[model samples]
Target: MATPADLPDSVYLEIFSYLSVRDRIRSSRVCRRWKRLVDDRRLWRHVDLTLYTMRPKVLWHLLRRYMASRLHSLRMGGYLLSGSQAPQLSPALLRALGQKCPNLTRLCLHVANLTMVPITSLPCTLRTLELHSCEISMAWLLREQDPTVLPQLECIVLDRVPAFRDEHLQGLTRFQALRSLVLGGTYRVTETGLESSLQELNYLQRLEVLGCTLSADSTLRSVSRHLRGVRKIRLTVGGLSAPGLAALERMPVLESLCLQGPLVTPEMPSPEEIVSSCLTMPKLRVLEVQGLGWEGQEAERVLCNGLPHCSVIVRPCPKVSMDWWM
Candidate 1:
């Protein structure tokens, strides 16, 4: 009978592609041939270390052993602990990553400590950078010597970062190429900072401000004035004022709008006002309203009746899972 070891190199590689990073390492121990095949650059094109909580030294060892210039994307999870126990990325490790993964375009870090890491040390080829529930200092965001680091970066997602504040937002305005920005669960960002930063990002096309406590109706007005080209927006903010709704109506290219969280208050725009506003938006296609409970049914009927060409969704707020923030 034939054995598994007899499989062709291509066949083995194909099979290995279906395995997770951990499984690939385990399979490498089976034999020297398997180990050699596991080191193929094609297999490490998109590395996902999200399930691992290894220290920086361990991560450096893993990357040096497996990562190559062909790497395109990397998703990593870090351990968040106090003092020496924290799994922070060091300058040396970041420099190694930039050198080893020159082609890396997307990098996502979750629950990481980046207090000591300068953003400039990141791979310059990166186009998208996401930091979730990470510890980032103000200096880290503001630090830039060349102003050319990560020049290709176009999308940035900062979610639940405790240190994110107005100064950080101002610092980000330097990235004029940014197109998609997601700020979720960031309460320190105020309307002034938002307006100031947004006006500089004329290229931004998608924006999501979710679970922001200070984001009120006036914030929407600022977005309307600064981001006239924005096509998709999802806001979880406080009660909507009439001027906010009116400002949104002027957006010539907006296609999708999602209003939820504090937007569901009894003071929300009436069905007639929402329908009238929707009428002015020539490109409006989807309008979603959440957390309205019984009050939403009437708005649903009115929206569906008023705008036959649009998709309208009205429902109570869905329970968010703990992992949603991460």
Candidate 2:
């Protein structure tokens, strides 16, 4: 009778594929054959090391061993401690990654220090890049001499990166294929910077600006004039006034609109004003109004009554603490 150890390598790999990263690591310690089977490149297509507490050297070794040409997505970040600083990502590691994972398409770095990494060190095949609470200068990536560095990049999300500013938006023009952009907690992006940046992106479809002061009539007018093809937009009421809201009429193809964040005490638009302004947008189908206080209900009613052809959703913003960022 054949024993379990006599099973073929393919069978062991099949079994290992069903295990979680932690479980797979545990299973690898079962025997030499199991370890070798676990090390197969096929089983490491998507690597996520966010949950593990690993040193930089250990992470580098793991990537070198398992990250073959087939790797598609890689998420690596350090856990936040009470008072201890997070570990910085090494330039050597990024250089090695660009060489080893040439085919990687998606890269997410959360709470990882990027001060040492160079923009050219990133793999050119990347399609989506997400940076959350990471320390790095946008100039490094945006100022690359070759505009074709991130040729296929479509989406970029920057959340709570204090160093990012309006000047960084200028760098985005280098990415011709960029379509969707999310900017959260970036207070430095002013109206002038935003208008100038939007002027260059004719293909931008989805845009979200949250927790920032970008509210200006001219800014929306600029958006209306430049981004006529925009399909989805999310912004705070404080960022847009009645005229600003009316400017959206220029985008006849807009499909969804979300208005969120705290209402500006005296400048908030009334329910009637909002309804009257939005009526001009012919293609709007989904409208979401959130984070407003008592007035949110009135706005919802007016939207439902005025725009029978569209779907309206209204909800208050959830309470978030500082720990939520972690």
Candidate 3:
């Protein structure tokens, strides 16, 4: 009887997928059959090496040889490519992966530092790209490349990263079919990228530009005109004023609004003012304004006097208390 290690390359790869990376790497050493199966580029569709804190050279070796054009998703540990000792993922490697893994759907990079190898041609079917604490350039983020390369690309989430410093929304025009996008901590996005990003949201239903700056006329006007598909908006501002709430008027379908900021004097709407102003929104079911605990006292009163038709839900410092108001 043929042992598991003695199976044909095709048959062994099926079982190989079930084995852990450490086990698979071990099994790759057993015999020629297992080695060939492990080396077979098709067997390595998803490369996630969170446990292997090995050298970048090892990671580079795996990506360079094993990952095929059909490779779909890639998740990696933190990468620190600097100094004299270690180098990050090479541009050649990235371009190779970009060429070979034309079917890549998701990429999650979790590291303190990384070398940004901007990909010119991404997989047409790529979706759900995530990066953490990596130093990527603006042109890379805002590349107006061919959409045929990334036709189905959508859902980009960045955390504590600086990819938006230069590019902002320049690259967003390429993703014509984008449905959901979260731009957290890409503060480099000034008014230029802000306007560019917002104006081209033909299919953007849920957009979260969390930490990008939009404190200018161009921003408010562009947002008012283009981001009219505003259903869920979370804004963290220096101060919240009547004019800010007035922006909600533009978002006719806005159901939830969260305004948060850190200042000695709270700058959020009083529960009364919020209920009164947002009374026109009969569909407005949820409104959260943190640090505005002062509003809790007069919330019901303002609702009864001003906008008596809709539910006036108000909570201040609820986030701190972890409160979920009824």
Q: Which has the greatest TM-score?
A: 1
Residues 16-72 of candidate 1: C-alpha lDDT, one tens digit per residue: 999989899999999899999998888999888888767677687778788768688
lDDT of 3 by residue, 33-91 (tens): 67777877666778777555667677666766667674778876654544446545556
Please give each candidate's TM-score. 0.84, 0.81, 0.64
Which pairs clash in model 2?
A: 215-239
Candidate with top lDDT is 1
- Whole-model lDDT values for every prediction: 0.80, 0.76, 0.60
Which candidate do you rate higher for TM-score, 1 or 2?
1
Question: Candidate 3 local accuracy as lDDT?
Answer: 0.60
lDDT of 2 by residue, 247-323 (tens): 88747789988787675546667767777777888898888777876445666778799889889888876476222
Indicate the TM-score of model 1: 0.84
**Alpha-carbon RMSD of each model:** 3.5, 4.8, 7.7
What is the Cα-based TM-score of model 3? 0.64
